[model samples]
Target: MFAGWVQERAGETPVRPRDGRLFVAGEGRQYVLLTYTLKKSAFSLGAQNAVLPLLAQASNAARASVPSAEVIQAGVVLHAAAAGQQASREVHTIGVGSMIGIILLTWLTFRTFKPIGLIVLAIAIGFLGALSVCWLLFGRIHLLTLVFGASLIGVAQDYGIYFLCNRLRADPQMDSAQLLRRLLPGLGFTLLAAVIGYMGLALTPFPGLRHMAVFSAPGLVFAWLTVVCWFPALIGAQTLKAGPIARGYKSLVARWPRLTNQPLTLVLVAVLGGVTVLGCSRLTVNDDIRSLQSSPPQLVRDQIKLSKLLDAPSPVQYYLVRGATSEEVLQREEALKRRLDPLIAQKHIAGYQALSNWVPSARTQAERLALIDARLLAKDGPLSMLAGEIGEDAGWAAVTAAHLRANAAPLELEAFMRTSASEPWRHLWLGKTEGVYASIVALRGMRYPSIPVLGQAAEGLSGVQWVDKVGGISSVLGRYRAYMGWVVLGAYVVVFPVLFPRYRGRTWRVLAPTAAASALTLALLGFTGHSLQLFHVLALMLLLGVGVDYGIFMQEEHERGSDAPWLAVGLSAASTILSFGLLGSSGTPALQAFGLTMLTGTALVWLGAPCFIVTKEEPNASPVLA
Candidate 1:
């Protein structure tokens, strides 16, 4: 019933076109523009109703049933349904395989059902906790935040395996408490450094990154706690046997000495590092926000098709106007339009739309009526002379009064809002926001320069705000990338001071492996021709913790007791790589970058771990792996 009402209101009118051209009533434009009601799921102004889609479908079904029907109800959905549904199905199918692969990898590596269940439980707890926290903060979870939460899976996987691997390598006399003591410092430091990075993320203005930081920092801590608190009590110290996989891993890394131990190799590695840095310097940094999302090709094509059919490109920028009263807002919009009119004539912009165009201010309306009287209704005016020539039936005053009664009446916003005509342009009205009447002037095909012009024009006007959602998001990314650079610099300054008391002169050793590992990984990215993005930096957050974990854990393992130095660290590193490598292998650009960063960084850290190993012959171990 409501659909019928809407149809009748938007249907063709009796007023004929001038020169075969008519203004689209609601838009106040010479050309007809198609309208799409895009519903945003967050921070909404009204209730959601699914009835529109159902009505459209029912109308289409009726038209199909009745061949006599002259028109059919259809939408862009008809052209898009198959591709969209197929894309969703493919995504789910890929996700299922990835989840199964994670289970199988953990199962095969641990060679037990208990470790699998334990690790999965920890991940589940961590993921659920992150989601719950996000829900509390935003009142709803964002899809991007969920992506960040999923990134934690690699770190979560490491937390479980790190402690569980220690169980496999613990001494015969070792108690659960002894194992906890040995692992505590390393876990604590790695977790702290990671949390610090996330803390920087939380400091940013971007809500997505802030939520990611909140989700990850606490989620990782809880996962680590699960390992530290429960893994001991659950798995007792019983000199557990190593699987065949462990033996092979040990034998493989044992060759680290021959590969990296020589002075010649060290000098060559330094040269390679220099070359890598040079190459990385040559790589470009693109902070374009569009690259962050990898929309499928079919979806992209469908969007283009829809936009073309609409006969208007989407508006990328908005000039928001405000006032204490509706009249003030309308007057302000008229002034803005005057400025915009010149730009349109010069072809700098396509056009703009606002409520003011349809409902001119009362002052402007009076001016219009006076201009009509002077030019056409006066005794000597063109219309009066034409009336005399054509033998008119009425006097000038009668014709003038009729004209005043018909077209000279001003359309106030309140009265206009009650009419059927208002429904089409109602969204342009932001309503009484904070006691200020507000409306948005949407600009189409606008360039960056137009943004500054619009903002400058509204400078003296109170409550006027210029908003460009796409540009603003892109700018935020550009700024945050710069912010994280400062954060990384800050981390280095803070890290050295904190570690100074513990390692003193040897503090340099603690920093070397990660420093080298990070540089080489970034260099590898340059080598692969993959541009670094915010995701790469976020992935580096995970890598930072992993590198520190390897260095600290290896140092702790050496100081304490271990049947095999490389075995426990290797297992932990392998699980991280295994987890992220699989995730990166998927078709997502962001996930692939993340997985690649973790895979490369962790592998390098593992290879470099033996650099800190002190053999009996030398306290400063000869150049080995790492």
Candidate 2:
């Protein structure tokens, strides 16, 4: 009775039993079950919403030729209950712990009883500005954008310390206004360059990169303004005077001259360079999107469960199929599926979701309708009863004839349209072209080899073109690493040659130390079995920039016989090393990468300065002997 009702309402004939199962069929092909579900509770709404439309449309179009797809809404409530319990425990242990650590760091850095109050204010203002700018330009800030922007805590503190440090250095004879004038230009220039570097990332096509660029650029400016304009005004410069020397730091400075002139420093840096080179070669790029997520949330867990039950795997890789019409598109999709079948069988791929499995082309749909019509005609004994009173009436016959005439012109389905030529789905059989029309097939759990799978897949496809968009993150990071490496190298090459044109011959002296330091750091990482990733490469490049800056500063200071040069280098290195060194101790992988790179890079930069390389003009240039 249910089958009869479904066929009558759907304007199609039921070809099989009314059992609640997903079905797929084609002309001259038998119907097969794809998946099944059980009706249970309200939580099954996600599944119902996704599957109901396809089932209804298929049943209505196929008439009585295919069974209606069943709706299974069970199991979600139980899954949600379990997930909630797990989340509560994790929040208390991990989430609260991270919060406390962040708070403690903020307090120690600011060194004020009211540091928490000030930090809250700074965060509030910075977030407001970020949200306003993001909304105005991009409509929404992605979750990742907010997470990365929080890193401003580290970057912003640099500006704050610079301000406080300069304020403390100024002679007590000068007032606050004089102190401000002395520091503003240098601070402003540094902040401007930092802003420009971040803004450069916006040029990339990646959404995440764009978000980082937008949030960081403005946030840095705000931080600088806060430190220079607001922070000093609120906390007087007198409050920043160095306290009584700690025993550990005092002893280190007392031994500073001996440590600075040590011959073993060069040898140690050389050894580290060899190790870094080896580590660099072993580094792997992970493009997995899930790696960015902190952990799987409850929704993801439920989705995973549904995916397993429905035999519909979440796609780890996408296969894009394109054509001019629905039929052409489906044909291409089927062809790609055939090529992937072997990989699936070999367990190289878990499974795939393709449109060909759900929606057939216009030609195929028409052919199936023709077969159903022929079958109904062959059963003439029941046809009259099936047609009922409508078949005997002239008005009804005319209406049916007009309906058939309209459908004969080829039905236009929105699902078959493609947007662009470059996109997998470009061509459409109906309507004006707007966006590329393509179907994404999710690859099941497969251990994809490191080699290019898309190239091999493309080779098999021959005339049909296919592209993989999954590796976009790796590509972007790789390009950025390359660009930043060149930038750092160019900065050293150009700046040194221009500043010391006659001493350009000795450029390698300066570069050798920095290079050796970077190499040794990477070598240590590799020796420790830590594989360098994209972030590690980028961090190392930044370390090169910092190293070069220190090398230049130290070389210039040595030429002037400033007794305070060592002190400046020591303090500067201490500030950088302490901040970045702490970063290496972070639990987060990306933070640790940055920390390790900076820690090694700063130490090398300190040791690699051309102090010992005594130029021809100053052959007796020895701060130690003086």
- The runs of at least 3 residues in candidate 2 whose Cα sits more than 4 Å from the true structure, single-residue gaps closed, are 1-143, 166-171, 174-189, 196-200, 225-241, 245-251, 257-269, 278-294, 297-305, 313-318, 333-484, 487-520, 540-626
- Give candidate 1's error at residue 414 in angstroms: 3.5
lDDT of 2 at 293: 39
Query: How many angstroms is residue 170 displaced in model 1 relative to the true structure, after the best TM-score fit?
Result: 3.9
RMSD of 2: 11.4
TM-score of each: 0.77, 0.58
Residue 265 lDDT (model 2): 63
lDDT by residue (tens digit), candidate 1, 1-626: 34874454333232233654533332232333323454543122121234345646765876799755432223334333433343344344433444565567556556667877788778878778777777887786545456446556666766667676777767768887788787787677777766776676687677767887888887887888888888788877753455666557656755555334568877877897797788688666777776755655655665654443333324556788889898899988898888778887766666776787678888898897788767666666676666667777458546765665586566689998889878757878988899888998876555566666756656665656677677688787777777776666677677777666754545556666777877888888787787877667766665666676666666656554353546666666766676667666645566677678878888988887666554444445433342
| Candidate 1 backbone collisions, by pair | 260-623, 261-623, 607-626, 608-626
Judge candidate 1 at residue 447 and give its lDDT: 58
